[model samples]
Every structure is written in structure tokens, then in C-alpha cells.
Target: MKVKTGTLNRVRIIGGDWRSRTLNFPNQAGLRPTPDRVRETLFNWLGQTLYGKTCLDLFAGSGALGFEALSRGAKQLVMVEQNRPVLDALKKNSEMLKAQNVEMNHADGVQFISRETRQYDVIFLDPPFRQEYLPKLLPLLPERLTPEGVVYVESEGAIDPGEGWEVWRCSRAGQVHFHLLKRTHA
Candidate 1:
């Protein structure tokens, strides 16, 4: 459901230095932020601390996952958002939090991934649920991750972890099927 323009909606940081802090974001269609429970669970699976880890939040909507990582001690975070208004809101939230570790990019997630050369310790993939981006994006992830890196994916339905990848953790919350994935060794 799309949040009406001009209506204020907030998402709270679940843990870390900014625990319990709330960030207000403009609601746009297809801009669903990962739910608090899911974030908490995902982080728990990730061990609750991201100190010195580099992260990438592809298709960053409300900047929720990226900001959460930063709050939990990620050394660097890159958030890529395509929507102008949503991107503006993300930038505002980053500035409000005085976030120095975040790098906001106004770009398409697919395009960014196709050209990105640096590897990330953790990558968050939460594209618009209606798009069939997973089939295309998943194939590109392994090369983007550091050897021990992980990819957190949120989808509307079950996802098949294609070649060279394995599901490390999986759970469901309502209609969301979230998974933590890792690359399999040859």
C-alpha cells in the first residue's frame, strides 16, 4: 500500500547506537521498508554487530536497512535508490542523523551492480516486490561479495538460490520471504 504524499510515516532503528530512534520518510508506491521484526531477525542471524563491515543497500527505499547497518557499526554503507523523492527523503534522514559513513547514490540498483567493482561484506536486496529483479540480480551478487560476505534478500515469495549460492537462513513474516544467502565454494 502506498502511503499518501505529505503523510508522515516513521520507522524505528531496532538496535545499536541509534536504538529506538525513529526516522520519518515520505511514503511512495513500491517503497516498503523492511519491517522491524524482520530487521531484528536478520541482524540476529548476522550476529547483531557489523563493525568494520562494508555494506550495500540496493534499491534502498526508506534507507532502513542501510541506516540500520550503519547504526550497528558498519564502517561504510552505500545506498542506491532510483526514485527522486524517496532519495531525497533518504538524504534528509542521513543528514538528520549526521551519518558520515553513508554514501547516497541516486541511481538504478541494477545499473549500479552491473558496474560496481568493490566487494561488500554485506549486501541488502529489497527491490520493489512486483519486479522480477531477483532472477537477474541474484546472478550478479556472488562477484560483489567478499569471500565471507552475505546477501540479505526480501521477496514477496519463495526464491530459488541459483548456482553457486546457498541459503544460510530463511524465514517468513506475513507475505515477506526473507533470506540470508552465502556463496558456495567450488
Candidate 2:
């Protein structure tokens, strides 16, 4: 769980059978998973209704967020990661958990989202902070997300949902911000 000097340590998986399990993270140039406290808060907001919901974890770094959803009770989980090493680690973790419902995709998160036709109930987007990916990512969400799906986006507190997205809730812990947005049904 030793992170590089001045960097953060391994984030705990938060809940379920994998609770307290710490996954290793490589010293890649730009990689920061959501902190455990923020994740716990997010899941608490989600409550006990995640069962049977399909989930998509974009920018699935350590696959921690997606795994937590699966552990809780997600019906199917799709992890999209572009980094080879991260994808490898995600695969190993999926195997370790015997996650047959977890599907791993090695590609750009945006590209996958654009090509994805199947919709998901929950989508986790934890891209690098300050990258300003939400604006671009938000518009594409309508296509991949279910009509009433919930989106959990963790950023450095810069996301401003103008008018198209109906933000259900927003909260911040430390420097991290969590958003719960829902797409209007058409």
C-alpha cells in the first residue's frame, strides 16, 4: 500500500466480502483512484438498491470502484481501461473474485462509450482530476446510459452541469467531489 513519495497509498475496496482488501497500484504517470472515504459515501448514497443493476466503470484504473459495485450486488459490470498494465491487474482481480459477470475492455473510455449500444443503470467515471473530461463525457452519456440511470462522477470539483443533465445530488469530501446525475427519460 506504499504509494510514491508525495503520492497516495492503495485505496481500500470499501465493502462487501472484499472489504479491507488493498489492491496494488503502479506508479504510472497519472493515476489516482477515488479515496475510500469518498467511495463509501457514494455507495451509502446509492443505498441497498444496486442489486440487478448493470454497471459501467470508465477509466477503470485499479478496477476498485467497479469491483465494489459487483461486490455489493450489481448484476453485470463492465470495466473499460486503456492502460495495459491496469487492464492486466483488473483481469487478475476479476479472476480472484471469480467475477464471471465482469467484462473487461481494453480501449479508450470515450471510444468505448461512443460505440457502446447497451445501456447501464450505473456508470462510474473517475478520470484524472483537472482533465475536464466531464463536459465531453456528459454528452456522450445519454447514448450509453439508461433513461433513468445514475452517473457517479468523481472530479476535482470543477464539473458544472448546465441544463441538459439533471443533477440529483452533489457532495465533496476534502478535494474530491462526487456527483449523482440522472438522464431525463425521453
Candidate 3:
């Protein structure tokens, strides 16, 4: 059951079970899927397979990171998107892919994360760059991540991982500055 909201653009999954498969997302402001090269590098840094890992995509704009994680062997995935139309398209794509062990939430990412009790092995954080989302959201992530968990961030400029965290790996793709961050031991 495809969501018939409007004309949609497609982004191809870079690797894993759904590699080469495409998912549809609506044309909206500040909704950019992580580029293929960026994803490839990210997965390389995170390792090829994500078996048994539970993942969260807080700003699941196009379900790109969420779906990619699922395809790469994540055990469970939770995607939270505030936009109804975008969430609808994500549902349509998830159905099309027949993805399993996935949960969808139609709410603000920060709000969802604020009340979320479960810890995750990985969390994808790619919010709109125009707003100061990273600063607000970063402080909330440490508590949500398991001891070994990591956060993948995509932003317009370099991010300060705050006092107790560190950027484990980072790379640039055009204007996008992506990083993998983990909590540092004291």
C-alpha cells in the first residue's frame, strides 16, 4: 500500500539486504538523505554488518538511515518522524520492502528521545541544518545510548561532542560534515 501523497523522489540503499533497492520520499525542505559515499564510509567505520544491534533513527526524515540499518542486519529499529506526509511515505516504503522488526513514531524526535527508556546500540541523528537541533539533541543522547552504543551525526559544520563525548570518526562530503561519536570513558 503505497502512500499517495505527492510526487516523490527515490534514494537507493547503499549496502546490505536492500542494496540497490530504492525508497520513495516526498520533496520537502531540509530533507536530504545521506549520500551514498557518506553511507559507505559510515558503514565502513561502523563495520559492514550490524547483526543483533538495536538502532534508533530519531530524525527519520526519509527512513534512509533506519532502512539501511535494518538492511544491514540491525535486530530492531525505531524510526520517529514528526511529519505526517513524510511518515506516511516511510510506512509505504517499509511495507514495500517488507522490513521486519521496525517501529514507527509520528512525533518530534527530541520529544520521542526525551521519553524513550530503552537503550540503543546505534542512533542516527540527521536533522535540518537551518535550526540548532544538534545542540539541543546531543545533550539528550548520552543517556539513551548503551555503554558501547554510538551516534551517527550529519550536520552542516563541525560539531562539538560536548564534555564527556568524542568524535570517533569523521568525514566530509560536499557541504555535509558527518561524524561517528561515542561516549568517552573517564
Candidate 4:
């Protein structure tokens, strides 16, 4: 939780190459890193090792999901965060981990996804709660996902991903509702 060195907060890598490794970030509003328990469950649903998978982390606050994917063998990862300070913190964490496959973007996550043409094996979506970001963004995700690709969504409440998306797996931890989804049609 709180790593009392200055104003930094820390979170540990749940599993993978960096298991037990701690990452630090500033106290920024709306920046909740995925909890260790939730991440462990999500990764278990997706598999322990990503191995050569390309990934994307939208609204990548604190770089938790993306960095975890990297630790598990994700070959390439692109993380988009709107907040410059938060993005800088992500870069700092990336450097601390000596990660080479990460590409950080200081841009609006929604706009980046809407304009993105590349497809990925996995995508992490944990936008700020109560913003109704899912409705505007989910429609844009199917196209960005490679065939068989899965999307991991974390939200304040259960979400209806509409038609064509199948709920592969889902679970809840207190106020956090997470789901692993895949395209059901096409």
C-alpha cells in the first residue's frame, strides 16, 4: 500500500518474472492500481505467462497491468495515460524495471484506442469509475483486438459489453468488478 519514502505509494507484482517486486507512484486522483488479489485472479484467468503476446493498457494508471503483462512474457506493450505526471511515473517505473518492450504514450486513452489500428493479444481497460467510459470505449475495442484476443475490464459495477462479446470470466472484489471478455462473433 503506502511505501513511506516521500510521497510515493507502492504495489507489488502479483506473479511472473517480477513477482514480489514493488513499484512506486505518486498520489494522484483517480489512479488506483489493480490490487494484488485481483491481478492474481485476472492473470490466472488469462494464464500465467503471456509469452510473445502483444498487449495494450488503456488508462494505464501506475502501469500495473501492463507491467505485469511484461513480467509474464508479453513481447510488446503500449500504455496510454492522459495525465502527464502519471505518465511520467509510468516511465519511471518502466526504467526501474529495465523494461524494453514498453511504449508509453501521454495521450487520452479513449482517443488513442479510437484511432489505433494495431491489434493485440490482450488489452487492459481500467478507466476511472463513474465516467461511463466503457460504453464509449467498448465499441472501439473489438476492432482493435486480434482474433481470439481477450479484454480485461475493471469497473465500479458489472458492465454489459453488449452483443458480440462473450464473458469469458468474471469476479468481484468489494467495489471492483472485473471481467475477461472475448469476441463471440467474428
What TM-score fits each model? 0.97, 0.89, 0.96, 0.95
Worst 10 residues of 2 by lDDT: 1-10
Sort all candidates by lDDT, best to worst: 3, 1, 4, 2
Over 47-136, each residue of candidate 2 has an lDDT whose tens digit, in order, gives 844788999999999777898998888999999999887787788778777876889999998888988999999999998777778777
Q: What is the Cα-based TM-score of model 2?
A: 0.89
Model 1 scores worst on lDDT over the 10 consecutive residues at 1-10
lDDT for 68 (candidate 2)? 90
Per-residue lDDT of 129 in model 4: 96
Clashes of each: 0, 0, 0, 0
Candidate 1 colliding pairs: none
The sequence of per-residue lDDT tens digits that candidate 3 reaches over residues 1-186 is 344446788999989999999999998776889888998999999998999999999999988888999999999999999999899999999999999999999999888998999999999999989798988899999999999999999999988889878999998999999999999888
What is the Å distance of residue 14 in model 2 from its true position? 1.6
Output the TM-score of candidate 4: 0.95
Evaluated at residue 171, the lDDT of candidate 1 is: 98
Candidate 2, residue 80: CA error in Å?
Answer: 0.6
Q: Model 1, range 1-186, lDDT digits (tens) per residue? A: 535788767999999988988888886877778999999999999999999999999998888899999999999999999999888888989998899878889999999999999999999999998878998899998899999999999999878889899999999999999999999999
Clash list (residue pairs), candidate 3: none
Q: All candidates' lDDT scores?
A: 0.92, 0.82, 0.92, 0.91
lDDT of 4 at 60: 91
List the candidates ranked by TM-score, beginning with the highest.
1, 3, 4, 2
Q: Which stretches of candidate 1 lie over 4 Å from their true place?
A: 1-3
